[model samples]
Target: MSPSWEDESAAVIAQGLRRRGFLTAAGLAATAALVAGRPERAHAAVSGSRAMPYPFTLGIASGDPLSTAVVLWTRLAPSPFEVDGGMATDSFPVQWVVAEDASMATVVRRGTALAHAEYAHSVHVDVGGLRPDREYWYQFRCGPHLSGVGRTRTAPAPGAHLDHLDLVVASCQSLGAGWYHAWKDAASEPADLVYFAGDYIYEYATDATSVRWPYTPSLPADFTRQTDTLGRFRQQYGLYKSDPDLQEAHRVSPWMVTWDDHEVFNDYDAEDPSLYQLRANAYRAFWEHMPLRSPQRPSGYTARMYRQLDYGDLARFHVIDARQYKTGQLPGSTVGDTAERRDPSRQILGTAQEAWLLDSLGSGATTWDVMANTVLFSRLDSDDTAGERFSTGQWDAYQAAQQRVIDTVAAKDAGGFVVLTGDIHRNYHLNVLKDFEDPDSAVVGVEFAGTSISSGRDGGETDSGLEVRTRANPHLVSADLRRGYLRCRISHDVWTTQVRAIDRISTLDYRAWTSHTLVTEPRRPGLQVS
Candidate 1:
């Protein structure tokens, strides 16, 4: 006989209570040491013992892959929910090995990194000197406990001839909304790398209407309120990382990650000094959880997130930071087009980033120049009435900045410029026009906006407002309201994008399918429905 829903819920709640109690006790004991200013002793050898709990609860990940290097990451969290992760203030040496095979018999590179308590015992080992465009298996050991093996690959040598590259684009995975069945499906794909555009963790408080609960019956105490402090943000990441499907996705392939507004607050800007401390805390936690190199680490509230990744001469991924340095949104009706929205001084990428992007695009090195963007690049009209409507949170809000980018792409004649976007919890395929207002404007590029992994719970095949919105914006070719990611196959001649979607996310037993296949060619900016 199966357990009833009430019984299952009760069990989950009980587990949360037990974990919370343990965290309270551990926190109190650590407070005394902190107050006394006692120095923490380094435990160089706390091997697997009966007294010590297993520390790889949050799983392991790899990201920021280069031609000869990749970053391997793991956090020591025996009790992930605790503020200290049930760890003492002492640091521990973690041994890491990269193997040619899944079995540990054939080893290539090995090193030991010290996991410090200041960074929540998270270890980021930036392994270098590996062969380019090769697969490598890595694992971690502290004392006697061994972590689950993770697979990562280095990028191809620069300008090396490559036939094809497979990548998965995903974003906006709100833990409380639904289960991550989409991520499980993504892990099964033949992907070289995964680009997590943004919104890795939502900052909203616990939702009463959550469809599924993995760890607890409701959100834990730290996650019951909006995530503002470092401790709360860490707890949020712990909960999100605990998902088996998410962990599997991370374990399978290298990831390229960036942040959206939800990582800090909903529609936040960097101009406000009052929110700088909060932003600082959020940025620090983001770095600790992700598999990023030290150069991308946060210094106070600022971090350099925009960078370029090359896949031989086949493709170039321009990982963009659209939110970090942007000016605040214009004050007025959110949907209505106002004069302030067109102000030249209202910047999105700011001066330095804009210059970098333009210069990178000018470098005609690769066949495909892909933008790993967070928000929609094409203008989206939300209101279909006589008056025009636009989202202030998107590129449409900063018309001058958008125009500059479009002009640069046209002037440079960038090859097959494609933008992979997330954040809006719906899929859209649109032709990026030189001027959104001109219906006959030349198509400068194409944008494939992927839906969320599980943001809006159990979304349908099509939204009610899809027809009106698509009609208002002629550049938009297709739209789907479902929870999933995009599988992109890139070659020198053509680029294909499969809009993969799951039937439902409310239940574990869900079906995934390719809803649409869109293709584009180099120097041919428009998308063709395949």
Candidate 2:
């Protein structure tokens, strides 16, 4: 008899895995059982004693924190490099517990979640009914196997008075570029929350000259190619998450994450309908790997990520999605001052998002309004000559959209407006002006653009063209080419930002230091560099 369609599809997948040198005898058996759709085999895989390998190799994480709820994440991946994470085609029950202490003696919340094979055996438990502004320790348990413990906390209650809030902003970590020493350092810092602006995983092929090579069990064949399919993207995520240092950062604090271009493609936009399938695959993989809630899950190629997070009356976080709704860049140039660049119709954030942002800012709900943006929010002049030049990928490309935001903030008299940005792989402090053409214009707010975690390899304190670039743009206060993150402290009266820089990233053991410290006050916009 001819093979059924499902059998053929399974055969093709198995052959691809064999070609990639990832399919073992046990993996082949698992794939065949999944294709056969035998409930008996699926049931035995989870029920029989010692029938399945130990899962939960990817570690545990918590994200999307609320005053009374937090999402806990874990995956059943004994052999994570495999397409299905080396699990039987079945759903397994995973028990989770939240405690008030590290020992877990004082349990607060306990529940069970199903880890489904369709979603790579990943589990997301949205634990609620917890106390506000309290710390919790959580862990997961599979059949005879226990996952690591993770620490998390809830946000301050609404209208609650907060003396201060410490946050760490980080982004752009390329696994092949360098070591994750910066993440290790970030894990050690005292922070209330961690905001990962973008670039959680790069969709690039493996680097032949990777500093950390000969990975345990070797990298899958898919790593040799750029990620465009769901399986490949999943493997890429598995590879990055295998890093102990990055895992430590996630285990230490609850992360608020968004995506940038590298997560799918370099400088990709939603204007092209033909790439919808690719986007769908990437988006699905992203959702499966992240500790996101049901609402953030993707439907086909679209997902709504723009939302607001408030920390009492102290501050409000407006996390924006810049890449998904962005239009394609102007043809033939990436940096310029062309007429079309200034067109009002050219939008970076779509009309709906723009309106949402404006309305939220106009509400004036908190002492500080912070935009957790993914790109440089201030105009950056790259050309040293008399002619002005700007990166079209940044806010400079959509002057009208940027102007609308500025106008809203100014008109609404927003108490303390600040933009925390990442991307560009460098640190920058800019005085956001009402007019970029005139340096003497009123400074409506300030922008603290952070450097990468480990994207551009080892960098120095200053780049070759720093002096010229600084001279061209007077709004620029300082620029440092390094690998580190921004440590920010927000209070009712003052907001302090420390430009943290690491000594090196090519090597594992490196030192970190503060390159600059800047402060801004409520109702006052410009930075006072200390």
Candidate 3:
């Protein structure tokens, strides 16, 4: 029989009663089962009789989808900002349910996964044996408390023909900078997927000017300190996940996440052995919070995050990890086009990942090959007429590697290659050229670098430097310094991108609108403003 929402509600009510000392743990479990009107297997699996803390405060998320399966995630954190999330140093069985409808009346799968204390009592259930190209609602139950239901959709079969893919690309959401109105708006849409480009959570404490959580329960006495260790990183994730808007967005759609520098340390790379241990801790905490399977988890300091996910024959997304393997920025200004900056051997994506990306791009049979890349892949020449330079942190620092990737796309005749980027906290629409320094170079693809969710606070509409920046680089289209995300509608014939910007991020006012619309035809590689 299918699960019932009425029963879930009853379970919640029973949980409240248990918490209020009106019922024993076993009595509460039995009462919830009775209220749910479900069999023993349908209700949550009860273990200890001790009163348990509310564990779903961090909310639930689902992601890393496949045709047959997707990962459903939740961390047991009754006291989120506490050192250990208020979870005992033990394991608990978390019962998960997948249904076809939001009411959860039509159940498809139900299973129990052990929430491991070693990994912050988080549960990542790799539920499989499901139909493809459809939506599913899922929820978890522990003791008498039930989590909010999350909606997730699996990708179509590898060779299956499809019409389009609706997606939102977002990045750089610093919790303390502003509100999450952007995420709230995005969650209201019916997008098939969400691409978290990077900076899922900032590592540092809030500054004097930044707004912070008004009610940070369980926060450490010194919660303002920067995150560096495993415990601290886990607390950071917990703090960010506590945001309702972000949790709702994750609850609504499956996300493909790839982290940038802030997820570890700012602008860090694999070149330093000293940072490896810190990276390991950060990576572990990230995996613990995210709805990722075992394959993406860290084995020591190394985690294989760069991988490909094909959305049927319509599109194939190659999610890249730029921060983990790139070399340190060369000694130059943020936008200095030095000879060292253009060094051919300067590494980004390391060696193996580059090869893997090339292979994935070359082998893709889809109409569009999208790179869910963090950091800009295209060049951004400074508007300064005195001297032209580029951001050393981006692909511009290693122009040789950038060109190789673009050349591979061109050489393979890859159709409609698009790069979706985040970081830099701005909106940019640019033509990915064969040689960014040469105006006459062929346009291999187009790039849409989205603005942050709430990173830079409230920015004005007009930037005086926009004109000079675009004039210096002919391929540059539109640039907005505000905070928001990119909404892309992809099809076999055309790709449409909308720059969805938030008018203000400091307040609860959710005044957001599409600032610019751009479109690119299948065979035509350049972008045209709509």
Candidate 4:
């Protein structure tokens, strides 16, 4: 996967990922994949161009959840999700405001929105009344440009019992796989909200294992589209919305995203062909460059991505969709094959997002129940490691709907549960036991599972029998495959967590302490990492 990553482009792979990050996201994602993957690049970027430019040049974001209000995204760059930064800014009808005072002089909400370069001109409002857990500041405009002021907060009152929360949980990044400096050390820690939980960018069909920093962009980079075009899915979502450390970690924080399968590729399966027409152009370029949720808008290739978010009583996230409703990869799973990796009716969140996570955990209000889904929900018996052996991508290939969601949250009494997760690169901490056929019936929940902030496994050279398969998975408590991420400090009776990591992902003066912490308590049971 090297020969100059065959057909590379997207401004020379985001200027070599702005200059090295973490083994450049799987060595430049095997060279930004897809030389028409042996004949797939035809749809000719679905025509209809010309339009872009206004108060959107890749900036603004915020996604804190439940304490209510916080989901402000912006796009309209038309040239940064992958390509085509040419024309059309829908005659500039963009204006968005929110503030606890970032100098808008006491403004709390302002209007006028429209960055429609056919979605490439992104804009995800979801503002909502505000005042739940304070600390806000925002920006966005068009007529004379404005964006570049973001900081978000709200979510400290579903049961109110706060003392601390500072969160963070990232996942596979890839825009050339490097220099997000683990999101610049999670925007210098002291977090408030960051749960990315998915491979943000990676649609390129073939870049031949991009040998150490080399996918010279000019075509589409990684938006994936040899055919089924819509201007090559807005030029691969304007090359990952022109990365500026994923736009300064989405301008600092207010994110709770959940898309896993490289946003729209890896392990995909809406109906089949494992990425049916590249999942209709990566779901219309992932709701046209993030900040989504007007019901997952994206007209060209259809996108409805499931939803859920809450964090006031301290957590109730339960977010899922595991790549647009599943039901694939399990039919004779490959790689290292452990009898096709323990396939018990293989699935990953299907059956209506698993009955909306059992009616959102039987309609609970909040006091901790987070699951912000995307691969790795614990119980990894990863045999020879690869595919299967538990992991048809995640929730252990939906084993009878993940044991009916761990036997109905260990037959209910539920309260401070935790799942978190992100694809398997490394870093775990489990205790979520609950009758994997009773080796001891209840332990209930808790499962951090992060790692891979500049993405890819460098964990000092893999196989340590995978750190003894995380103590042979009896509700693992530690697995440090290494890389970094997963902060959680919450409190109100131990939320603790740590697993930060960073002797180096790139650097922003990082020291990122607490390589392990765990804790968990509230609806009480197993989990204690320290």
Cα lDDT tens digits for candidate 2, 408-435: 8888888888998888898888888887
Task: Give the Cα error of residue 276 in candidate 1, in Å.
Answer: 0.7
Candidate 4 Cα misplacement greater than 4 A, ranges: 1-60, 64-84, 87-98, 101-104, 107-132, 135-137, 141-152, 155-234, 238-253, 268-313, 316-331, 334-371, 376-391, 395-415, 420-433, 446-530
Highest-TM-score candidate:
3
Q: In the order shown, what is each candidate's alpha-carbon RMSD?
A: 9.1, 9.4, 6.1, 20.6
lDDT of 1 by residue, 1-530 (tens): 54432333234333331111112334334322221222221111222253445677677899989899999999988777667777899999998989787654577899899999999999999999999999998878776556666789999999998899889999999878887888879988637999999999988776555565332433347766888889888888877786667877898899999999899998886799988998999999999999998988999999999999888999888889998899987765365777787889988898999889988984748998888899888898877778888888889998888888899999888778899899899998999998888989999999999999997778877765888898898899889898999998898888999999898877757899998899999878799987
Looking at candidate 1, what is the lDDT of residue 414? 73
lDDT of each model, Cα atoms only?
Answer: 0.81, 0.79, 0.81, 0.61
What TM-score do all the candidates reach, one by one? 0.90, 0.89, 0.91, 0.34
Model 3 per-residue lDDT at 81: 67
Q: How close is candidate 2 to the true structure, as a TM-score?
A: 0.89
Backbone collision tally, model 4 = 61
- What's the lDDT for residue 181 in model 1? 81
Number of clashes in model 2? Answer: 0
Instruction: Please count the clashing residue pairs in each candidate, in the order shown.
Output: 2, 0, 4, 61
- For model 1, what is the error of residue 513's alpha carbon versus the real structure, in angstroms, after optimal superposition? 0.8
lDDT of 4 by residue, 464-503 (tens): 6676576456667677666767777776577887777765
